[model samples]
Target: MNLINKKVTHKRFGMGSIVKQNDSIVEINFATDNKKFVYPDVFGEHLELHDASIAHSLHQIIQEKVLEQKEEEMKKEEEIKLQRKYQELRLGHEKLMRNHKLHPESQMVFWCDAEEQNSSLSEWKIFSGEIKSGNNKGKPNKPIRLHQNSAVLLTAVEPGRPEEDRRILGVYMVKDGFIGKLCEDGYIPAHSEYRLQLTEQESDQMLFWNYYVNEKFPQKQTWNTGKYRYFDNSWMAQILRDIVALKNDTREQEQAQQFFDHHCKMNQLIEQDLPKPNGSLMRA
Candidate 1:
């Protein structure tokens, strides 16, 4: 038997050991480290097994690794699916663009990381370098310090609520992680105003301090941050997401309106000078 490096769990031996090996079946000595038991016929020959102190620990590491692998695989699969979906969506929009009757200014929404790999539109340009996803990292995929307005621009806005609708429509990507919907398309108005919701609790007090510290506010932490109770990351994340949405909505709308005004003025000037169909006397 060639099961020298095979790691195994022993009820009696505890953890550690390598397969000394034998002819009939297989013999595994589990008395390498605090463990003391011999297992046979479990792991086959030609396998390498290591010793573990806690039987569960060895299993735990294996399980964790397995879960990690599974998560990575799932992420890759999702990326593939997302790529396909966006491609299909892009083709659909291209088809729509070909139809003269279809208005091109419809606004829509979609999500993005700092990377443009998953953009819904062809024009999407995501942020690069450490701000996006890093080549190497302290924290995994850490987002860089973001400007309030720029952050809003990076935020995705879809035809419907992202929570309810999986497929957002009509948004286009521009340079530097900037994306917005066209007027004729399903676009969300971008704004950058936010409202804070806090309560008088200990944990809330801590959060207040966290926010203040983050904002460089020298304000003292109140009893709220100390006593505040929150369910978990999800609840608070939702609030943050909402605030970001509101802020972006305000900013984009203002910008969109400005464009409208400029366009309207230019159109009016052109129409005034252009020859009228009648060309007779159709002045107001």
Candidate 2:
């Protein structure tokens, strides 16, 4: 790395020997007079080193710098692209809200098994709750209220905790025109189009009781003995907004917002009409 006393040739100075080298600065004694130049920068264009080994090392360093610069530029470009897409999605959602054409019905919250959900989340990417009664008993239960574009919030009682300690596990949009099919013990998709699974830490932060406590039965959880129930769009909207706030990374936030906007547009609601992130939903 030291270039003291090394012979080098310059386009203007004719011939020179490095006299002092300090960090990036190099002073050389030339036939005409003393000259100073930035070390590797001069070597890149205006000068050439007499030592081949040192020249090779400088070449490698220059290559590395070029590569790093390119990578940083690419990263910036990607971030800009993501921002533009996020803005476009927001604009589209706002336009839909103004028109009132985005009506989504049949939204519900279902009780999901933690173990089965964990597996499906990683592998099948499907969900189903069992139907215990009626003509379709022993099959995967799809509520009559569920439809395409409907949002579903999945919940499970926290492991090692009482039923009162139930937590939300995931949120999903039922796939348009999807027919029920079996996956393990239940059905496919609930007919899902978009799905977002909460990490274990995230699940812990969102308790089911905190969001949907029964007012009449204050001591009871929202669903005491049901597979699922029709959920209000207003409540769902508020939950989606909170999910967006839960993300710390910019891309993650964008993704959450994307899902929020999709759900809002499908459900014929605007962000302003709903409660703010983490705000309580009003019950009638």
Candidate 3:
């Protein structure tokens, strides 16, 4: 429109000298000694652009640039939001590990289900009980002992599966005061040998084992006995180290100490309530 460096009249500002012109906007110096920038498409009718073809071309370019800018800004905002969400998730994971008192140095056992009946990893449950003194020909052997606060590296045997890989189920810390005789509690069927119980929180966490499983130990290792057992060899050690660091960072050691202290107190109380050989109450 050759409006650049030309005198023109703005509908509102009145009688202004065009100082600059670009694809998107035109800047003008008003007679009142004020400066204003106007978008051509928005104020094209209000001002004069002598060349109609030039005005149309500039308008299209301006529209395109504006759309591009909006898209770029939106992308940046999304990136920022994603980064923030990740940080929150990391913090939440650390807090969870601490609350459970999970640590790498703690003694842990690898528990797995190999039976064809228990094919689904989601249905696996750990058992604890003493085996019957005499070997019952058809009965399943029960654990002789189980302890509260025990940690286990859990897994399910995967043989001929599509992935052909054993998955590492996340670590679990046994709940406090949940250990007892399977036969006495009646929590499960009489034939079932495990008496250990997990809290609702612990049970729900198990559902997300796929998310928690250590990815570093992708390959499966086998421990062969009468049957083939598959497990992630490095998963337990790696997860322990990671959780230990999380617990320390979250300052959960103090909470852990208090838990043990209370546990000891409860044990003492139980011992005191026990009857002596002579049938007298035992001293605390």
The candidate that achieves the highest lDDT relative to the unseen native structure: 2
RMSD values, in order shown: 23.3, 15.4, 18.5
Q: Which lDDT values do the candidates have, in the order given?
A: 0.32, 0.69, 0.42
Q: lDDT tens string, model 2, 1-284?
A: 88889999999878889999886789999998899888667786898899999899988987887799899999999999999999996776565435433234356777767676676565533445667778977766644454445676877885787766677788877655432221234444533336777788888887766566455665555456766666567778777788888877897778779888987886778888775433222221
lDDT of 3 by residue, 174-214 (tens): 44433322224211121122122223333333322332322
Candidate 2's TM-score reads: 0.52
Candidate 1: global Cα-lDDT? 0.32
Per-residue error for 260 in candidate 3, Å, reads: 24
Regions more than 4 Å wrong, model 2 = 1-105, 123-131, 134-136, 179-193, 276-284
Which of the two, 1 or 2, has more lDDT?
A: 2
lDDT of residue 71 for candidate 2:
100
Q: Which ten residues in a row are the worst by lDDT in model 1? A: 275-284
User: In angstroms, how far off is 40's CA in candidate 1?
Assistant: 19
Candidate 1 RMSD to the real structure: 23.3
Clashing pairs in 3: 128-194, 129-143
lDDT of 3: 0.42
